[model samples]
Target: MEEAARAGRTLLGKRLLVTGGSRGIGRGIVLAAARAGADVVTCYRTPGEAVASLEQELARTPGKHQVVRADAADPAEVNRLVAECEASLDGLDAVVNNAGSFLPRPYAELEPEEWDATLRGNLTAAHLVTRRTLPLLGAGSSIVNIGSTVAFLGMAGGVHYTAVKSALVGMTRSLARELGPQGIRVNTVSPGRIATEALDEQPAEAAERERRMFSSFTALGRLGTVDDIARTVLFLVSDHAAYITGQNIHVDGCV
Candidate 1:
């Protein structure tokens, strides 16, 4: 009970809404926020063991936590998600836009539909979610949009992905300027290659090739982990970052 009580005060009662919180980096953020004493209402697109497992883990935490199913790209679903966050968490003090799609294809072979899907999934989804959730957030609220290092360095087969991520950086700056008057802060967290389930799914040969390539490029001499991004996110939303806003923070290990 003492430890639970301590955990509940970590974020000083901040309520957070995290998109795509059931898996990968999203899962890491949800869990970390809960541990930091924030009541979290997170959304997932599907039901699976991952969602079930996160539900169980959050149950042990002190703050209120809910995992719901909502397609971040759909406006109707995003509205429902915002409503659920308001209903379940009372109000929102922070938002983490971590839901995005990464579809890699040669620029020459990319279809119009694929390009639209990638934009809707990565860029438009953030706009929709943020616009809808803005009403619930007030002064001192923070928003962190998850971007990729590819946005800066560019990836050969991921032109669409990189383009949308680059847009997020611009969006972050614009939103920060517009919302700063209200004491709201917005920023982007761009991560390099991180070891997530997606990374594990790569063919062994491809994975090894990437490992060898990234090792020489990164100053830290290895890839990042989900926690590497999560910790940065946690700080960005906390009071410690009160004076900071409209910044693009790269979590990539100096590549």
Candidate 2:
């Protein structure tokens, strides 16, 4: 399936901007987008080993791509990101608001500042990028907001995170209505506890425990891979999902 996606060129000739592409699921999507034949411009918040590794991996991909150091949560940086996108690829065929941070905390312990920061990074960033980049999108273009399944099912210790994540659903629906008349589509691709870099950072025993715990939550009895979510986004932005819009497509394994 992976090889087929590479050969298929699902996003052939498409120009895309994916935010928060330095690590985790965002990193996976960036790699998948380039491999699927899109001219990609992705951003990272800080410089580190992950950023360096992403650049190296993209170097071997088959499309024109750029990795910029920018914070999507900042309006000024988002403006700069859009400018770079326009300059690099002319205009965008798709925008994936994948840049955000997640720091789970108990509702009692969550500070007001943390809530505000979370909103800025996760919710406001998507709005800023989408609004600023609207001109670069046109008929047949798509905008996908990376969301979370916890928004629907709810989380015990993450009310703040859940609130912001849930906002994507309403945002996507409204934007789809607003942009549909212009022939643009908007949707949310919510992931369900997909294993990512955080897992790798855990001690082996703890990581195994987490993997097993998360897997037990799924109907499929397995955790989802980054590819599972990436492939879904690929379809959503491609001609295959041309008729679909304003919906939340969960990439979880029925968790």
Candidate 3:
């Protein structure tokens, strides 16, 4: 099924800008877009093996691609990143606001600083990138904000994280209304728990506990994958989802 899907180039000739595209879910979307025939410009925060690997993979993909190092939360850096994208890809057809940070802690233990950082990393970063990229995105363009299922389910220790994610849904609605006349679509893709490097970093007991808990609750009896979210993003940015906007589509397996 996956092989058959890859054979269709849904985003042929389109140019895309994906933030935090060197690792995790962002990395998956980057490769998927490339395979679907979109010229991609993606940004990473730091230099590492993941970035190196992504560069190698993008080189092999048929479409024009670029990987840059920039801090999504910093306005100055975001400006540079967008400038590079415009220069490399010529113009943008889509933007995926996928750069985010998650810090789980009890609401009582969450300091003001931590709350502010969480908002800036997730919500503010998306706003900054989207604001700057709007001019480049003309009619028929789309924007997909990477939200989380926690925004709806409300995790116990992720108040700050969930708050920002919930805000993203509201943002998407507002943006869709504002951009609708211009023929641009805006939407959110809220993902459930997926096996990523971050999940593997959890302590043995905590990881196992979550695995069992989510498995029992999720109807599919399995966690989602990066590819799961990536495929949805591809569709959202493609003409297939042209009529879909201002909505939060949960990629979670019916949790």
Candidate 4:
């Protein structure tokens, strides 16, 4: 408990904005950023129990943080969210594009709507957030786009999702070069088979079986935790990684 309250200065006095902070890996990044001494402004798509819990957690952590209801995929909402970030933190030091959706559907069953939505969520959302927040960022600013390892290793029934993730890598690389002179860095952090709380709720036998299967997929023979992804992102956004840009850092336990 004492460790939880101890704030580190890795991102001391930095201003950060993260999308999709209500749950899953996004929530991990948000909490980790706050604990690392960043003044964070994170957004969610809707109001729910997740928001309530995140608010309570942030309230207990050091430094001021804001949680807003906004969708990063929507242009209007993205604009509003960035406006709020500027209002809360004055100017941004970093941005994390973590909000996205993935629904597995076989090629034959995949519909046009599903393809469009997945692209909007996984690819376009990152563009919208990054472009809108560019004004607030300056030299030494970092932008980390969350991606997936399946982008490299294709997954059946997820062609649309994989394509969107693939686009993120391209986007990150191009932007890193384009923005390099401005001292703004862009990168992608691709995670593989991370075990989250939802996995714990699975039936004991089934969860164990799934974990075993995914663990074997990696050279390390163990599934990843949210901390694995979060820590890599923390380093990328901090000054410790000042020279790193346009790189895709994978936290997949060597999968």
Candidate 5:
């Protein structure tokens, strides 16, 4: 199935901008978009080891990829990132709002600054990125917002993250209704617990419990991988999903 997807150049000529795309699920989406023949621009706040590895990996791929330095919480930087992507790719075919931060502080322990930071990174960034880049997107283009299953299913100690993540659903539905007439599709991909950098901070016992819980919820009896979310995202933005929009597709392995 993976090879078949790679063989299908359905996304050829598409130009995409993905935020927080230096690593984890965002990196997965970047590679998937490129594998589907789309020109991809990924935004990152810092250049880490993952960034170096991704650049090396992309260098070997046939697809074109550009890494832009930008802070998702900064409106100015977001606008500049869009302009850079447009200049590099000629136009915007899709915007994948995948850049987000996860800090699971308890409600009482959560500071005002934490709340603001969470909302700014997760919700506001998506809105700002889309708003600035929409001008470059036209008919037949799409926007894929990366949401979390925690949006619908509450997770304790992750109040701020869950609150902002839930916002993506409403945002995508509204954007879909408004952009549909213009032939642009907006959708959300809500993923379950995936083993990514975000999860690396989890306490061993807590992480084990989470694993057990997510596995039980999923009939597949396994945790989801970054590639799973990436493949789903690729389909959503491709011609295969031309008729789909304003929907939230959960890529949580049956959870």
Candidate 6:
């Protein structure tokens, strides 16, 4: 507990904002940032028990937290969310673009709506949120874009998801170049197969087979957890990474 407390205070006085933060990997990042003493403002598309539970959890931390509702695909909503966060906190020190949706439809049968939704939520959303929050984020600011390994290694059925994830890395590098002179860092965190609600519905045998496939490819012989990605992000946003920027760090246990 003492060691945990010390870790929680590592980011004292920093302010952060995360998108799609009501649950899953987003929730893990929010909790980690709060525990590290950063005032966190997280956004969700819809509210439910998870949002309330997150509020209670964040309240126990040393820093402050705010939860808002925003659909990343909507530019108006993204602007409002950033405004709300800026109003609640004095300014933004870090922004994590984590809101995304993935539907594995075969390329031969993919619909126009599916393609639009995937790109809007995954790629366009990051651009909108960052542009809106640019004024609030100043020198020493960090922006971490959450991507997937599927972007690097294209998946057979998730063409849309992989495309958007790949685009994000390009976006990060370009933004890093533009923002570097201002002392703001931009990077991408590409995670491997992480067990989440999306994967929980698979048959046990199928799941095991899939797990084994991923484990065989990973040097660590296992899948990643939300906490693993969260901890890596926390490190990137902290002062410890002051000299690091414009890089894509794969957190997939040596994939």
Go through the candidates in order and give each one's C-alpha lDDT: 0.92, 0.92, 0.94, 0.93, 0.89, 0.91
* Evaluation by TM-score, superior candidate among 2 and 3: 2
Model 5 C-alpha lDDT per residue in residues 1-255, reported as the tens digit of each score:
978865786688889898998888999899888877898899899978988888887787777788888997798998789889878888888999998987889899999999999999899999999999988999989999999999988989998998998888999999999999999999999998787765667898988888788788888998898989998998888878999999999988777
How would you order the candidates by lDDT, starting with the best? Answer: 3, 4, 1, 2, 6, 5
Kindly indicate the candidate among 1 and 5 with the higher TM-score: 1
What tens digits encode model 6's per-residue C-alpha lDDT throughout 159-231?
9999999999999999999999999999999998886655667998888898889888889999888899999
Runs of candidate 2 with Cα error greater than 4 angstroms are: 1-7
The C-alpha TM-scores of every prediction are: 0.94, 0.96, 0.94, 0.96, 0.92, 0.94
Stretches of candidate 3 above 4 Å error?
Answer: 1-7, 201-209
Q: What overall lDDT, based on C-alpha atoms, would model 1 receive against the true structure?
A: 0.92
lDDT of 1 by residue, 113-231 (tens): 99999999999999999999988999999999999989999899999999999999999999999999999999999999888887778999998888778867899999899999999
Off by over 4 Å in 1: 1-9, 202-209
Model 3, position 185, has a per-residue lDDT of 99
Could you tell me the lDDT of residue 244 within candidate 6?
Answer: 91
TM-score of structure candidate 2:
0.96
Q: Per-residue lDDT of 1-255 in model 4, one digit per residue for the tens? A: 656544456787889999999888999999999988899999998898989999999999889899999999999999999999888789999999999997889989999999999999989999999999999999999999999999999999999999999999999999999999999999999999999877988999999999999999899999999999999999999999999999998999998
Worst 10 residues of 4 by lDDT: 1-10
lDDT of 3 at 238: 93
Clashes per model (N, Cα, C within 3 A):
0, 0, 0, 0, 0, 0
TM-score for predicted model 5 compared with the true structure: 0.92
For 64-159, candidate 2 gives per-residue lDDT tens digits of 899998888888988898999988899999999998877889998999999999999999999999999999999999999999999999999889
lDDT of 5 at 181: 100
What lDDT score is found at residue 52 in candidate 3? 98
Number of backbone clashes in candidate 6: 0
